[model samples]
Target: MIHSLVFLNGFEREITVGNALVTSYFKCGCSSFGRQVFDEMLERNVVTWTAIISGLSQNELFEDSLRLFLKMRHGMVEPNFLTYLSSLMACSGLQALGEGRQIHGLVWKLGIQSDLCIESALMDMYSKCGSLEDAWRIFESAVELDEVSMTVILVGFAQNGFEEEAIQFFVKMVKAGTEVDPNMVSAVLGVFGVDTSLGLGKQIHSLVIKRSFGSNRFVGNGLINMYSKCGELQDSIKVFSKMPQRNSVSWNSMIAAFARHGDGFRALQLYEEMRQEGVEPTDVTFLSLLHACSHGGLVDKGMEFLKSMTEVFRISPRTEHYACVVDMLGRAGLLNEAKTFIEGLPMKPDVLICQALLGACSIHGNTEVGKYAAEQLFLLEPDNPVPHVLLANIYSSEGRWKERAWTIKRMKEIGVVKETGMSWIEIDKKVHSFVVEDKMHPQAVIIYGVLAGLFRLMKDEGYKPDKRFILYYLDQDVKHN
Candidate 1:
């Protein structure tokens, strides 16, 4: 159309005609063409400048968008709310914290901080840059915190591991009488993982039901995730059954919950059910299923499912899928096959994949593979101590004390200290974590006394000390002491 206009009509087009063509191109997402028209214009107004900047920003050319903003300033075009909003969005996309701060100052100087769109964009910018503190400050200082600002701040806190802060603001939002939408709940729930507080999660779940957000797929998925992480498999299943709609995430969550609980059979059953229900399994779903198979030692079942991932589902196996296959093979004591599989992988095996093989080697006492895996893992993550520890354990089990000592010496030289294993149990909403020989607890003395009495009773019943329980440092004198 522009070519026809130039060839038949003339090269000399009216400013209004050029602007209309540019606007049409910008609307059609042809920012480059709009920019060409913009360059050809003899007189560029504020609207013309804003249109191009907005177009560039929308197209994700953030730096170019920002550069255009600078050009608008050089041309003495006074920016309006739309100009600032577009620039702020560019800053948010690029996570340009310094530029965003400059924009904040400009907004303040222009006395447009109270403008909802500008303020919301500022909040989103800070949040996207991981500056939750700044996001919260803007949110609190806003004359009116709309749902967009509130949800952005809430999600920012949650994603940054400030779960407590997120929940607090959530309550305050409720008290201030802001309507909580499913999107807000979904954003908050996305950050709730295996380590989140179950009680707090339950409160969120109850709120979802009370607010009638339970019917929302996002809310339902959040509930499924929260229940799964809380170790409430039954509740997770209940939520799954009641969900009016189920996405791949819902199925994956249930499969993951069962896998985590070591109920591989049930996980497999659900996988099959998911197929029967016509909900296709995703990569994550297969990963969870593979984990279940590995843990339950279902070698044949695991292999079949792994094959189905590529053949039946037509999903290309990624590094994570390969890692699971290696883990499953290693865990089942198919050491040679595991090594061959890793070597045969199109992509290089990552440290986690190698570490999985090392763990299996430790359990099966395969010193050869364990040593090789340890070497590879050490090269990948020199600071990690697990590979060294596993290697030491393998040598010790094989009665190769000299090799074990050498491994420990190398670890010491590298300043790698084995982290003591700790287990935690949540009781009555409080978590209690303990390490072996931990004497810092108030009830440590009483717990030791009970253990001593139990040991005595076991000794009287012809029980003997399992040398496996003793640390390498524990000698006769230490045991007596």
Candidate 2:
């Protein structure tokens, strides 16, 4: 109709009309049609350029989005904040950090760094690109922090394993009277994580109810995750039951939580329920199911699910799925079968799968397979100290002093020093950290005395140290010490 009208009115294509049509088509999910109109436009402006770039990005054609942005720049079209925003999103989707950095420099050159949308986009780009420090620096330097920017940085911290810091910032934001948006609330809830105190989870649950976000799908999902991760499976189920709407993520989370808690039967039941309700399972759903089988040692059920995923659901298994299968088999003492499984994998086995087998071998004391897995791991990820250290421990456990010494020598030669073990506990709002053989704490003497007393009590209660568990190369005096 537009083309007919143009023909009837003898109207030359106006840039504004062309831009509006392009945006409309793109927004309506017709990027190809939008491109057709765009190509026909004799006179294009920055709006036209931005429409195509942003549309491509929104449609997940990140490469095309970036290519168009570059072409716009080459055509001498000045980029607006939207153009930079779209380009940065493309970079983020592609994890093109170098290109993203170049765009950051352009933002400075364009003198639009103060624009809130641009600043928020920059923070998001940096966060998604795995530069939390840069994202936090932007957050700190911003004269005004809006809810969006605050949420972005909060999520960034939570995702990067800075849970304590993320929780701290959540407190600060609340104390500062920032309105707790649903995403912010979700981010704070995520900080509860796997070690969340039941008290903390209940507190957040109360907050969710009080804030009237109990019915929000995202908030409900977050609530379920928090409860599940904190080992309150009943509470998680309660939340799931009460949710007004549930998405794939909600179902997946519940399944994963059940699996993680070693309840494969219940997990399978939930999977069946989800299917009965016409909720199609995603790849993550199968992963969780496989994990349940692995943890519960349900090898037959796991094999059935793996087969169903490919044949019935038509979903191809990923490396994580394969790893789960290997773990399941290895944990069952099917060492030869697990090795054959890896060798027959459709694709090359990843380091994670090899590491899984290695860990299982160490647990089952299969030094032969452990050696093979450790060799594969060394080739796959030489920089990682875990494979080498685990292999050395396996050798030591088997009393292979020569192999253990060789492993140690190789580690030293490669400059791969394992970090000293450390553990920490938070008590009464304070964190106390301790390392192996550490004696630096103010109450170290008292702490060690208590530990020694507990050890004595255990011995008196018929506890005996397993001699076979001792490291083979330690002298008797050193072991006693």
Candidate 3:
């Protein structure tokens, strides 16, 4: 095809045709061919540069796209909206916050910051790069915010764990008279995953129905996930049953919901139904099944799916799948088998896999194997404090005071301190965080009083605090006090 194009119009003269050929080749996934044509071009314009950069970004060749953008700047081609858009996308993919900020500066320098599409893309880039503050700044500076712009900001907020802020912004956008689209609704639904208020979820569901977006597959799937994560299995089932069309995501979500709730029989039944409906199971589908088997003690079923993943579906099990198997075995008290599985893995077991085994050993008071897993975790993630903490807990549970004391000493010697446990609640669009025994809240006295009252009532009702969680270094008198 290149030969034919070159034969018809000598490459140097037909810059337009050459640019078209580069774009066509890139669109066809022939990036090498596109580069060859781009290299052969004697007269490269902004369009040609933008075409290749956009193709590379869209195809997820982010580094190459950024490199070409650098070259384009050196080539003295001033970037327009398309160029900035593609480059910003590449920045997002690579999580290049510095480069994205530089591009934002370039946008201001070029006097194109007013371009809504470019502004939206900039917010998206900053959001994906973990600069939510910068993204919010871009959004606040926008003269006229569109639905796409609002949606990107909302998604950014959600992805960055600013759920309350995201929900507040959604409410603010609606109050400002911007028409909400399916994408925006989907983004809003994500907030519910973190904020597990059944009342709030149902209010959103009502809004979805009123807006006639109830039938949207994406929205439906989001509702299912939100409900499941919130521990409302019935609501998730309700959403799944009401969806007009069920995709693999919907099926997998419902299956996972049941599995997570410890109804492995129902989860397996749903998987069978999904297969009968000719909706193929994805990697996520198998993950949910394995999770159910692990939690529900259906180890045999989990093993069968692990084998069938490769043999029947021709889908290679990823590290996550293998980790699930290890978790299942460990949880079922098959500690030796789990260790053997890890040793025999085709790839190195990640720290999370070892952590799972270590956790299971802690629960079952298997000190010997737990110690080995903890040591492996120390090697895998030297700076991580979890293994050290968990190992100490395991020793404490088994009444091995000396070992627990040694573990604590080793943690201090290695300069590995456990992070303080913290919790947060979002109230009226504001998030308030508190650490253990926090006294920072304005109403801390009242809150503490209420908590003390609840603790007294719980003790009266036969609730007992587990003392094994306390550090063994502390004296028994101190612990009692």
Candidate 4:
């Protein structure tokens, strides 16, 4: 009604009314109308642009947001700090590292300083773009460190496989008297895996209750994620049910928890419940739904959801979504169909598709498909040791020792190296790290001797270990071609 009134009165031509209308429309989730109001405006300023750009980003229309930012610059309008911050967020959401770097350069050149929101957005962009080195540099160079910035960088480290680094930094925040924040708790919890997060998550849950943060939607979502990561599906459900409010993230989190716990039917039920409550499912929700179907061996159902995502929700499938469909087929032992699907992609296959196909091929002993997948990986990421290692394993299983030798040899000739794999275990209230192999442990010989005995016994009893789990030590040598 108010929108109609504005249209009837021609009030959208006023700058303040137009800006507020745009921002309010986006906040109310009527983005199409927000866009219409924005386009009808006769005058636009920095605030107007910021409102529209930020609204576009908030509505998950990231590419449009950045396009408008570029257009704004081309029109000789200077973007203020809020504009840059919103643009950085769009870059982060899109994972457009190149554009994000350009924005960073422009910000530095324009002397935008001491704005924590922009600093955090910068860190988020670099981190989400998979450049933790740049994120750390930005964090260190900051003139100030606050709770929000620290939380962003901590999340960067945790999500980018720097779990140990993230944990150490979380300790620093505690020592510096940083108050507990939803983001901080979530990031710290994310630094651990499987059983590692449970104890800390519980402690944090207690702290959240003590501080009256239990009702916070963000924290509630974090708890759901934390419980799911720890494999405590029941606990996650309990938390989800207790929340007085739920957003799309809340629903998606619970659904993902069900998917992670191998309860595809319950995940579907929750998805149904979400839709019945008039809550719209986002791409992440579908990712979980597809994952549930994939792992549950519901290939036909997975295909249906894949179609529904784009058709019903009007979401364009991302690389990850394509990867899931391939994963669905691959996990169901439909190697030929998986390959065909990849061939039919509108875009070139990415690392996720290659990795999924390679793993599936390994499981099913589809040597030809495995070789093709590994070759694609070699071309796409030459320095990556995973394809070389996994392909060599495929060769080893087929008694094609020459091909295996060539694969590993090519890896060495190109100076490719693999990070040392690590595993941990807890027993009798103590944790042990055993990835040191023969290097650091005082009783390495004894441990290996015992392990060898166990393997011998298991083999004698007709038990065989999965060959995919074994990582052979790389011996360096040159290769032909």
Clashes of each: 0, 0, 0, 0
| CA lDDT scores, all candidates in order | 0.83, 0.85, 0.86, 0.85
lDDT of 3 by residue, 1-481 (tens): 6658676666545888878888988899988888888888888788989998998998899999999999888878877789999999999999999999898899899899889999899999989988898889989988988889989999999889898788778777778877888889889887775445556677778889889998899999999988898778998998899888989999999998998899999999999999999999889999999999999888898999999988899888887888889889999999999999999988888987899999888877788889889989999999999999888888888878899999999999999989998776756645567777788899898988887778677768876556457533112343453
Model 3 residue 118 lDDT score: 92
Instruction: Give the per-residue lDDT digits (tens) of candidate 1, residues 320-383.
Output: 8788888899988999899998888888888888998998888888999988899899989999
TM-score of each: 0.76, 0.88, 0.84, 0.76
Which ten contiguous residues of candidate 1 have the minimum total lDDT? 466-475
lDDT over C-alpha atoms for residue 383 of model 2 = 83
Write down the RMSD of all candidates, one decimal each.
5.2, 3.4, 4.4, 5.6
Looking at candidate 2, the ten consecutive residues that score lowest on lDDT are 467-476
Model 2 residue runs over 4 Å out of place are 1-21, 28-30, 40-43, 195-199, 422-433, 438-447, 460-481
Global fold similarity of model 2 (TM-score):
0.88
Q: Give the Å shift of residue 341 in candidate 2.
A: 1.1
Using TM-score, give the best candidate's number. Answer: 2
Q: Candidate 1 at residue 35, lDDT?
A: 83
Name the lDDT of candidate 3: 0.86
TM-score of 1: 0.76
Model 2, position 370: C-alpha lDDT score = 90
